[model samples]
Target: MKHLYTILFLLTGLLSATVSQTRPDKINVILMGSTHFGQEGFYKQGPSMDLFSPGRQKEIADINKQLAQYRPDMILIEREPSEQHTVDSLYNLYTSGKLQFAQLSYGRAEQYQFGYTLAKQLNLPQVYGVDFYSSLPTRLMRDGKNLDKFIEDLNKFSNLGRSFDQQLKDGQLSLKQYLLKLNAPETLQATYYNIYINPARVTDGSFGKADKTVDTARIDKSHIGAEYISLFYNRELKIYSNLLSLQQAHQSKRILLIMGQRHAAVLSKILEDNPDFNLVPLSSYLK
Candidate 1:
């Protein structure tokens, strides 16, 4: 009888542990959009801009406020994975208190400086650039290595840059828009060629030995300038899957994904197919 009682107690303990491990903790993914125009009044006077303007400071403050509220375990950016070194350098500067910004007008230097500041203030662990880098040869390949194609590519990039600049002026573009634009179909294709294909050609040392090949089938299914959209969707799904797995493994932490406004629609649709996951909108926090 004593031996039987001991065996029963051991079985009960094992059952309780198994049940605890199988249960999942709620995972929250929040996708917040930010205004890249920085804070209002960040720039003052004719054609001159202050990188550290008051408005920019305010924008950072707002972001910081949100960070405090969310206390995210990780923050992901739309940076290219190849730019990891640059990312690491920025991270070190931020965490070591060696990062600082100066007042300036017009250009990427200011924007990047500000990004560094925000990442630092939040004490973010690692910043992941989920996008691919653009390459020159890839551009040539996509455009059929012709002058006309080159010109068209240039025009597109120029136009996008202008549109984004205009949005900054109008205060209409959010951080989400700024990031998504880089991964836009045309932009993504151009970038993929630049990073992936161009390098392959360079190694072969054949700049323009043969005619550019177009995969009509792939284009048909994905469409021109939309392949990156599909890639983004795919990546998001993988991220979601990883989050789910993590939840199951720990059964104690929740996940929140901060994504662009464009993703909200598709992500919601995708989640519908996956019954195990739940999709909650930012609106939940708004009210």
Candidate 2:
């Protein structure tokens, strides 16, 4: 009887431990893909109007109020991890009412326009920069060896949403509407294909042998295009790694990531496959 009682006590303890270890909820992450409100980088030809204009500001604020419903524990932006100190410093200044929105150099950028605004509205500690940047050996494609074909391959991947950009430029679609179109599932999937997938199709590396100018050391002889896109793939992988580290450190259950529409599309696919993260669709909160 004494031995049986001891065995029962152990079994009850094991059951309790199992219950404690079972997690009912996965971490919620909103991978928001956004255009550069600053009209910078590859989007230098973005909408002509100013983001700080009264109309645009109101649209952005509305988006923020909607997102605030998610009550994110952390806001992640497209800045480099190395820039975390700078991000924290700037956020502190903004939160303390010391940094005017107009004073920041990248103030018009989405990091400030959407990210900082939401963080301040929610009174969160600080925003995080989880971006990773690496230059591609694009020169491999520009070596005049099948350059025409390379250009053709790239032109095949033209933006499907150019009309939306035009509408935004012509004042037809409001900022919110334009963003919703951009984040729509079809749009993101198309973005992933255009920006990441299409590039890999440029696999003809036969130019290496004919073009004496080509640096054989760096260029992949048979898979030049795939090699070129690998850098982009690496950067995304690094950014995902940074998010994992941050999640572990903060033990955050809800995270909001603000990134370029391209990154958003790619990271969304990745986060969807990740077991620990519940990648919440933007339509859930944004709408």
Candidate 3:
């Protein structure tokens, strides 16, 4: 009886140890959605607010000052992982005073304006790029379905976004105000709907055909929108995975993600459901 009792106690201790090792510590995360500040033609189609303007510069400086409160151990950006070397090199130059905003062609970008700026302020080593890109469907299939109404509705939503960007460009809204508005719960929800749900409603289920050869047998009529939007889902999944990989390798306690507000909105939802992360509200620090 004594021998059996000793073995049971040893087994219980080993099991508890194993369980503790398998569960990762929760990471504090901040998903900061940003407007692309680069030149219009660069990255994607959106507003290109000039970051060099005296007014805009002051606004950004203040915004940076506000975000500094978070004191994240790791800063991540929307650039692809393959560009890690480029990010590392640029960050090194910035930290060493070898690189200046005037010297960079894409310096207006959030990667530089936000990510690089904040990392330098905190005196961190380097910023990480965890973005993953997959091509969106080239052609949307309606199969004789009239999408005029849907297109109109989508246009209305798109115009709303454009108008919001226009507000900052016209100086009607300051950069900090713009960011605050963008990060609001209602705005994030709307962005999520516009990017995913609204488009997924397309009934045609016809997107991303390699050529014009349509085989009726392979058509997925009931899931066209879901299938089409899966490209975006796949991209976000890989991005989230990359973040996890970074956390595992670095064991950072707090992380800040700087990306387009749309990506931020989508990623916030993803992080909210993840047990390993405690997603902090951007508004908490923005204010």
Query: Model 2, residue 62: what's the lDDT?
Result: 91
Report the C-alpha lDDT of model 1 over 124-151, residue by residue, as the tens digit: 5565544332222223324222335444
Cα displacement (Å) at residue 257, model 3: 0.2
User: Model 3 RMSD to the real structure?
Assistant: 9.9
The order of the candidates by lDDT, greatest first, is 2, 3, 1
The alpha-carbon deviation from the true structure for residue 8 of candidate 2, after best TM-score superposition, in angstroms, is 41
Would you list the C-alpha lDDT of every candidate in the order shown? 0.44, 0.77, 0.77
**Model 2, CA-based lDDT:** 0.77
Q: Give the TM-score of candidate 1.
A: 0.45
Worst 10 residues of 2 by lDDT: 206-215
- Provide the lowest-lDDT 10-residue window in model 3: 207-216
- The parts of candidate 2 lying over 4 Å away from their true place are 1-24, 40-48, 136-140, 143-153, 156-161, 206-216
Residue 43, candidate 3: C-alpha displacement in angstroms = 12
The parts of candidate 1 lying over 4 Å away from their true place are: 1-24, 33-52, 101-119, 132-214, 221-280, 283-287
Q: Write the per-residue lDDT of candidate 2 for residues 151-263, one digit (tens) a residue.
A: 66445534455677777878888888888888999888877775577656665553333233334577674676676566567778899999999999999988999998878
Model 3: how far residue 197 lies from native, Å: 1.7
What is the number of backbone collisions in each predicted candidate, taken in the order shown?
Answer: 16, 0, 2
